[model samples]
Target: MRRTFKWGFIGVMVLIVGLFLDYTLPQHDVVRITDTYNRVTPLGSLNRLFYASPDAGTKPGTAAPDIRFIAAVRPNGKVIVYRNEDTGWIWPPFFKFNSSNLQAEASAMKSTADAPRWVMVTNYGWRIPFLSTYPNAIGIRAVSGPDVKVFPWLNIFILVVLALIVVFFWRMWVRFRERTLDPLIAGGQERWDRTEARAENAAADVKSWWRRIIRRGR
Candidate 1:
């Protein structure tokens, strides 16, 4: 039972970590830019987390924000729409404040089905139609073709550094346990043993005195 519980806990932890990495890590998609446009879309509470905040100059509590979108078709004829917004000083740490410029770039690269201009889009997020959420496009560039390979060297380096950091902290924690925590725990056990011994001795002396008093009376 204990072994099953331990394995279950480890599986849960691994799943959580895998999902976190999948959501945060940058991914590349080679698609043909079909259209680029802006729309005044209202953000609901459920889907608002996927979108970026309004520009820094916008007033707070603004309703029905205008968001830019870039629509593209993958090589396999799958449609993927990306919301181009400025992730200004927020999560994912992209620091992308040039949404307007990116929109212009995407517009220039737009192509039709006959002569599709395959472009590589670097983005991080998931598109959930149920929640009305779209992936946030970080940057876009023209590629040779849809079959062009994209090596995620940045993601590889990031994962390596993260692994090293985890290893370093794990080693540090083990060293701390050996150097500080282990001795303190041993010392506590020794003190507890001494206290128990003293308690037993006092109880034995009291019983012996009571028996002597009873014998003398007899």
Candidate 2:
């Protein structure tokens, strides 16, 4: 029984750990974005080129610098705007923007302190495409975060199972260690007391018989 209980506890712990990992791991979803640039170059060369050539002598009316922006979600629920320029793509964390800033923009947007869901983006300086799909986006991937609300039923189920397991083990431990010896000790003590009382009664009866016999002889 002890071995069985130990193994059961170990299995429960393993299951709990597995569930925790399942919620925390990152999942990637890829989509095609229209206003995004998807060019790949040698890793270190792009940074050098951007630093070397900083100035272009073109007028503002000619054309804006060709750059694209895309949204990306980190594994921990942080949203980042990736600015793809002529040099290379840069990741600028977007969660820094507050609700006040989002409300000022003329776009379909929902912003809160920690949660920002932008249906469309209006900033045009970066020339990024507005991916219309909410579930999926182009040049941007939405990843899963460790959100407890996502699986309420599973969470409740696990919690209830764990509580019941704890209660069961506690009862077993009590029965194994405490209840077993109490009954034996109590029974033995009662037997000893009864034997002592019988011996005293027998001694008193023998003394009475001796006195009666002596008195009759007299």
lDDT of each: 0.91, 0.40
Which parts of model 2 have CA positions greater than 4 angstroms off?
Answer: 1-151, 181-218
Across 3-82, the per-residue lDDT of candidate 2 in tens digits comes to 99999999998898765534322223322122223323222432322211112232333333333335444335556454
Instruction: Give the C-alpha lDDT of model 1.
Output: 0.91
TM-score of each candidate? 0.86, 0.22
Q: How close to the true structure is residue 218 of candidate 1, measured as C-alpha lDDT? A: 100
Please give the lDDT score at residue 150 for candidate 2: 31
Off by over 4 Å in 1: 1-10, 200-218
Model 2 misses residue 102 by how many Å? 33
Candidate 1 lDDT, tens digit per residue, 1-218?
99999999999998998888888798999999999998999888898778888865666576798899999999999999999988888888889889889999999999999988999999988989999888889999988888998888999998999899999999999999999999999999999999999999999999999999999999
- Choose the strongest candidate by lDDT: 1
lDDT, residue 150, candidate 1: 80
